[model samples]
Target: MDTNHNKSEKSFKIPGDWKEQSKQLKEKFSTLTDHDLKFEAGKEKEMLERIGNRLRKNREEVLNIIKEINLS
Candidate 1:
């Protein structure tokens, strides 16, 4: 219902999958810089926030895009 809440939900389901998620992100958003893709341990929110800002999208939208990235 809310932006922050959506971000929370998206991240909640994948707490330990950041690296895999980041890899999937690279396949989809090729333009993302190394810094943009870096998911430092314990900094997932910062990672998502940076990505959301770069794409000019809300957290939910960012989450939605990445959610479609099937891990391989």
Candidate 2:
């Protein structure tokens, strides 16, 4: 009788609402001035990836803010 459990079996999922919110935020910031310079040196791809990372961080920060304000 094998009753062992695998830790890897546990998986976490981001809420759909949060995912949509993050997508919207990423799109919004993608057009901001900070992302515009990325195209000046022929680094559009790099700029996009950097903006993506920043957007992810922003999403996390927003989530934290909502939590702090007891809105989530």
lDDT of each: 0.70, 0.42
| Model 2 Cα lDDT, one tens digit per residue, 23-55 | 454455554343422333444345444544655
Where in model 1 is the C-alpha error above 4 Å?
1-24
Instruction: Give the alpha carbon lDDT tens digit for every residue of 1-72 in model 1.
Output: 555645545343453466787776777777676798786766777877888888788778877777666434
Given candidate 1, what's the lDDT at residue 16?
Answer: 44
Per-residue lDDT, model 1, residue 41, is: 65
TM-score list, all predictions:
0.61, 0.27
User: In model 1, where is the ten-residue run with the lowest total lDDT?
Assistant: 7-16
Question: What clash pairs does model 2 have?
Answer: none
